[model samples]
Target: MVYRGPYRVRVEEKPDPRIEHPNDAVVRVARAAICGSDLHLYHGMMPDTRVGHTFGHEFIGVVEEVGSSVQNLQVGDKVMVPFNIFCGSCFFCARGLFSNCHNVNPNATAVGAIYGYSHTTGGYDGGQAEMVRVPFADVGPSVIPDWLDDEDALLMTDALATAYFGAQLAEIREGDTVAVLGAGPIGLYAARSAWLMGAGRVVVIDQLPERLEKARTFAHAETINYNEVPDVVLEMKLQTDGLGFDAVIDAVGAEADGNLVQHLTSARFKLQGGSPIALNWAIDGARKGGVISVMGAYGPMFSAVKFGDALNKGLTLRMNQCPVKRQWPRLLEHIQNGYFKPSDIVTHRIPLEHIAEAYHLFSSKLDGCIKPVIIPDAS
Candidate 1:
């Protein structure tokens, strides 16, 4: 898949990736997922999202080749590649902060390298195609367990791991009330993971009816349609006896909708990196000294946020790009115990040829599409 411009992408022939470094490996993609973060690149939200870039960060594949120094993987190994590309020997990676590895991207202070995002993320071509070149092969890609489903393995690359990490950041104590903003895949997974973290109640907030219903059935959380309430934050506070939730998760990022001024300024005019509607709601909807976990994707630009309110409430704010590989062990156990099924949110499986159509459907929220998986060789 090649990006033509915003709202325009097409399947194009590209050269198969080759080993470019001693730590590199080439993988034949079996399944790749269009992440909600990918939508930011699709809408031209991320800086330097140049034309011809392939935008997919969640993928699973079979190792086709490996570099001379590669030790952990060999040909024919089924692997789930983490979205993060890190050298594993960096100062940050040494401490398990793989997302902040300084050895991968030149702009490592902002974020470590990522596959198929854009120049801002190290300019690595993503795995949305038939093949992808993976760097730091021994450090990043994990062999998929035999019992795991292919679709499930694909989501583990990003969504499932990120959501679980968000819950961990929230520091949810036993019986804590948690509120998740947005009913997207990340929010749904955050809600589900909150239960595993011992959250007594989980509430999901969104405007769409179908997504709200999904919060009920899929995440098994209480649902609040922001459209139905006069004030969403007040509604959230009311639900918690006017004390607000113990922990709040913001899963809606730059493209969030709620305030017209915020939408026009950030998402439309590009004056800010992203709209802070969901984030502001999180601040106002959390109790004093409550924790706020941000799992949403935002750009480097400034966003208008309620910093004073957050300070006044003494909210503990924790946010970061997920270190995907770090969360796999715990998530694997959850999957093995049947506590989570990453594929449950997969509502559409589209071939690479129809990716443009798939993007349209997802961007438009058509057909109740929750998540769309790409089949590069569906033909």
Candidate 2:
């Protein structure tokens, strides 16, 4: 099924995904998820998205077939697919950076193509169907433990992986104070990851009281409602004894409260005539040597800044798309050991037919819809 237009859903039969390479395997998608990235495709923001191109990436499925030369996996294995498809032997993969594999894309691009994305990717179909063909199966997919439910493992591909990457980039340590901006699914996962990484105090900031409350209940992290308390960074500093936090994860990105200060500083040169209040607040909120990890998706161009101030403060800023392959193993182990539960982020479960409704609830943040997992075949 491909998204033909806004709020449109059409089912079309596609060629059965088959094993085309020695390292390939065919997966029968048992469960798939709709991510914020998919919302871009839904809104027609991603160019060159044709009809019948398929439109989902996050999934957990069972292997129905494997190519002859495949190793370390076989038919009947259940697995979680990584969003970024990559060949395991590329230069980037050799450096433990599988997101930038050269061969998987082979389009003169450094990074591999994502499943069901625009032409920037290889136009490979997505997993939101009965079956999906996966390349580099041994390196790109992880077998799920028998005890894990398919829904719980679905996030290993994107959300959980992204949170794990944010945690890594934040360099969270035992007893360090951390603040996560935004209480969306990704922000919730970021908080959970920080807790797993041993942050002494993790505070999730958001305008929605429902989301903040859920974060407190689910992740055992503290919450500060940005709506009620206007000066969030000030409150954070007060809670942290005027030193600000050790790490801050900007999960909200450009959509943050008027492009928060950190974003303004990062993209200062890009901002034209928008309010700079949030930008100022974010800059003042960080401790001298604190780290900021940005994982939000934004438009192509924007501007604002104080590069000299950031440089002088010696703050470490790390930003990038979530490199799914590099973080899946640790996340899987976390799931296996019961240290993290990605399923907690899901607030709604609806059949594929109600996807538009789910999208409404998700986009409007209604009924506390944090992450709604869509079951394609469920009636």
Candidate 3:
């Protein structure tokens, strides 16, 4: 799938990607996913989303070729390439902050490079196509364990890792009540992960019944339909005994539903940062001394968040573009122990040739789509 501007995507033939750097590896994509964050580019909410640029970050593939400097992987190895493109020797990377590496994106002083995002995020092409080039191959692309399923590996590439990171940021303690806003893949993962992190009670909030049902079945959490409730924040407050949840995870980034004005202004009209509805809800619904972990992908522009309330509430707000490689070993242990199924949320499978229709289905939330993975026809 190629971006031809907002709301316009098409399948086009492109040159097979090849290694360009000494530490790069070219992978033949096997499975790819349409992440919730990708919609920001689909709607032109993010800057520098260029025409003909592939828009996928969650992918797993077989390494077709490895650069001479690649030490850990070789050709024929099945690997999962992380979304963050960073040099291992960078200052941030030395400190385990790979997402904020200073050596990757020349356009920014903070954020590191990302695959398939616009120029604002470093212009590396994404892995939506049959072939993708992975940089810093030795440090970024890890061999997929033979026991791990391809779909799970694809989920780990972004959704699962980000969710786990969000939970880690929340610092959920035993007996803590956690509220996860958004029934999307990341939200589901966060809810599930919170349980593994010792959250005593978990609640998932969303408007979609299918998604809420998924939350119940997949995440095993209490569900709340935001549309049916008289007041979402009030309901959350009431559920937490009028105090608020101990921790809240905002998985719905810019395109969250609720306020039509905020949605239109940020998502549709591009007048402000993406909608802060979930983040604000998180802030308003967390207890006086709580944690708000933001795993949602927001645009660079400003959003109308409640900072003063957060300050008054003494909330520890933790957020970042999840460093995918950081959470692998733990996720592997959980999956091996059968704690969670990363692919439980996959509702649709589409061939890469039909990716535009797949994108439409996912973006429109049609046919109960939760997570859609693309199987490239190469293999």
* Candidate 2 TM-score over all chains jointly: 0.85
Candidate 1 overall lDDT versus native = 0.88
Per-candidate TM vs. native? 0.96, 0.85, 0.95
lDDT of 3 by residue, 1-379 (tens): 7899877888998988887888999999999999988988888778788898998999999999988888899899999888999898878999889899998899889689999998888988898899999988989989888899989889998999999999999999999999998899999999999999999999999888999999999999999998887889999999988999999998887863224345456544311236676788899899999999988888754556789999999999999999889899999999999997899899999999989999889988999999999999834
Which order, best to worst by lDDT? 1, 3, 2
**Per-residue alpha-carbon lDDT of model 1 for 121-216, expressed as tens digits?**
899999889999999899999999999999999998999899999999999999999999889999999999999999999999987899989899
Question: Which runs of model 1 end up more than 4 angstroms from their true locations?
Answer: 256-264, 267-273, 300-303
Candidate 3 Cα errors over 4 Å, as ranges = 256-273, 300-303
The backbone clash count of each candidate, in order, is: 0, 12, 0
Order of the predicted models by TM-score, top scorer first: 1, 3, 2
Quote the positional error of residue 116 for candidate 3 in Å: 0.6
Best-performing candidate as measured by lDDT: 1
Model 3 RMSD to the real structure?
A: 2.4
**TM-score quality measure for candidate 3:** 0.95
Each model's lDDT comes to 0.88, 0.75, 0.88
